[model samples]
Target: MSENHTSTASTPSAPRKKHRNLAQGVVADISEQIQNEILKPGDKLPTESEIMRIQGVSRTVVREAISHMQAAKLVETRHGIGTFVLEPPPAQAFGIDPDTVITMRDVLAILELRISLETEAAYLAASRRNEQQLQELRAALDALLNHTPEDGDAISPDVHFHLLIAQTSGNRYFYDILHQLGTNIIPRSRINAAKMTHDDPAAYLERVNHEHEDIFNAILREDPEAARAAMRTHLSNSRERLRRIQESNEIKSSSDNTRQ
Candidate 1:
């Protein structure tokens, strides 16, 4: 025991650095490839294992990157088939990052933008929509009504419903703008306002569907004025609902702090 000695290395140990966020890095690389046209629309993405091996990332990181790309509308997954790149929207299309929208004010501002664009769109669609377009609109509405928000993300059908209206407007610009906004335009995408409206998500979604029906009916009847009014009312109601959610959240936060 008295002769015991410890050995130490002459060189100092190097500090370990944290790894980069592999998912975000993959998203950036893939998005860059798409932007550079290296991965053209309709081109199939590499298999997950291939991507993992090439990028030196885990399967989880690859999946996360794919999810982000889907949310951005850059790619779509086909069941039993590999994921494929989507055709890029026109250069004029407008895009808003979902992360930038963090408050009711932000949501209301976007709704304001929508009201300006869509009230006119509803009027134009009511007057110009053809039989096929009208049928498509109804189908989109039906999809929304049938979808269960509790079961999965309900934003796609809701966004599609509005996109169909924009397309019906016969103005390609309107459709491009909404398409550029993508699924982020759906209120549920940014906030859980549905729960604030009703404890049961189904009831809240049903109410939203009824509002949609009002707009659809107005468009179906070819009443431009009614369509405009209904669209305005629908958007205004959305803003009000989100405002209520903001207030409720504020109250809950206050109560939580008081308890603390």
Candidate 2:
């Protein structure tokens, strides 16, 4: 039995590992082509079947490669059409890495930064927002509230809601700063607060929407003091929520270890 097991283990199981490498190789090759201008922006990539035939890879490998490219923002897929190379955006002067944010302290620090910047933005937006801008702000808030956590499309609207406020401030700098921060401004990017609040995901989202409503109403009222106060409260509450999640996770981990 021992000799039989050794013979089976010694036999090469290279096919599965080779397929995984093929997928990664495809991604690297396509990225290099784009860099060399062989695949220009808006140029369509080969179809999945065509790629599979040409690269001698399985359909699964082709799809995995495409997914990697999309995640890197190097390409986009258009329904009824095909995947196309994308023009890279300009380099940001400063930004945070979402992957590096693993702890509640990191999230709280980001919230603190936002409180300092966005509180003033809300105040300025209250004074400077025009009628059309005010309407847009209301629309953004409505969009946010319209989606539940289950849909997984709630983050975009939430980001837009804050972005509209920055734009309304009449300071292009404020909007640029927030845009540079990208989706990291959304708390969900750093911490999956919705999933962590396992009691009721919909209720969690609704509670957040209520906070947004307060900020929106204050801005609509054109009360700078109220707007500033509301914005500050929203961010402070977010910090507390993340802290609670961190503590809960630690407790659960300890319990599991003790049981083990």
Candidate 3:
């Protein structure tokens, strides 16, 4: 031990610290460009090599920078495609980080958020959706209907159906929030609560599809009031199912804690 020496310059932590600084430098430059509108919303960021050249950073640093940008919500990276700048959230924008919505309670909170946001969206969609959008909605509906109940992975159609409603609502903010939320908005996708709570998950999903059909028919009829009512009932049914599961969980947790 008396003869041992470890050089800080060669330590792994030293290289990591250097890389973090370089990454932060890249993140700052790109963030400034976005804030200044130099990199506007929907505009794709440069290739990773381009960024490496411009920032004089390593590939690892550039990738780290992009990850930081995404975490800040300044950009969204589409796999196999480039990262694009996102429209900045407004000062009053109500946002929920999808990564944090892990628990059933978190999903229930999201349902409440949807109840307020989507009921109105459904009404607006019914009143204002064009023929093209309506057809798109039909295509989305059929996708949902065709999802084999044997598979529990129904996220794609479920998300598409709700996103179509938001897009059809003629409100960009509605679409923005829902799009930002993405597949995470579907609670069953996240937690598989239906499978846990229902004796027949397939039948539960079938009934869920029927609820979707009701909402679609209301929209097809262009009955705004009916659309709003259908949307409310659909969401309320989900809320009730989740509430039951959550209640059961709470009781079990309380019993376990008491025993402990």
Candidate 4:
């Protein structure tokens, strides 16, 4: 009698993009390009081949990122032509158009959006998240905490942690919009503002992570009210952090002018 033997070796897969920067990472990279005026409105975006080369992500990843940018009104594609940066139309009302988020004030405006949406998301996540998702959230947070300076900022895992919470909310809109905002939603990722403002950036990050812990614990205990409160506190603190940075910069500039 012949017996079938199971293979002990796992099937090998293609090497992942370093750190799995993925579609969101591509969005962030291209968004930064737009923010810095490297690719101005009406300018044609680089071809997929070029984007793939620059971002070290796959062509499919590039396409996915571009789709999100289109959803955000940051870019437009003409079939058989190419994608182009969009000139934002005049705001008909007071609402954020993510493309216009170039200044610190703009960032604060979007952070307000995050505060409103994510607070509710946390409450829902606490009430609805499954055991597997809870484990994923914990894993994402731990990755952020353990991320090394050598691999660059903790933005990837930081974004992942929040994305997981939104995913756990069981509402696709929350996940979709947050994914559309991507890393651009994070102030530190947007401007590296923390490093410039905080006397000790490490300590500041530790404090932020402490707040994350509070939120995580609330969800772990299935305390919806506490989860909402914890999210509010963390996001509110981010706003205050930015305000303080702005004030400190202004004061320093005034001092320099006086000395001169």
Candidate 2, run of 10 with poorest lDDT: 182-191
Q: Using TM-score as the measure, what is the rank order of every candidate, best first?
A: 3, 1, 2, 4
Q: Global lDDT of each model? A: 0.84, 0.84, 0.86, 0.83
lDDT of 3 by residue, 4-48 (tens): 445643577888888899999999999999888898999999999
* Better TM-score candidate (1, 4): 1
Residues 1-260, candidate 4, lDDT per residue (tens digit)?
12323232322323344324588888998899898999999999999999999988778889989999999999999999999999876766333456667766767777888899999999999999999999999998898777655567567787888989999999988988887565655534344656767546677678888999999999999999999999999989988888777788789999999999
The most accurate candidate by lDDT is: 3
Off by over 4 Å in 3: 1-94, 185-191
Give me the runs in candidate 2 sitting further than 4 Å from their true place.
1-92, 185-191, 256-260
The best-first sequence of candidates by lDDT reads 3, 2, 1, 4
Q: Please name the candidate that would achieve the greatest TM-score relative to the true structure.
A: 3
- Tell me the deviation in Å of residue 235 in model 4: 1.0
lDDT of 1 by residue, 31-58 (tens): 9999999999999999999999999988
Better of 1 and 4 by lDDT: 1
Which structure is stronger by lDDT: 3 or 4? Answer: 3
Residue 250, candidate 2: C-alpha displacement in angstroms: 2.5
Every model: Cα RMSD to truth: 14.2, 13.3, 12.0, 25.1
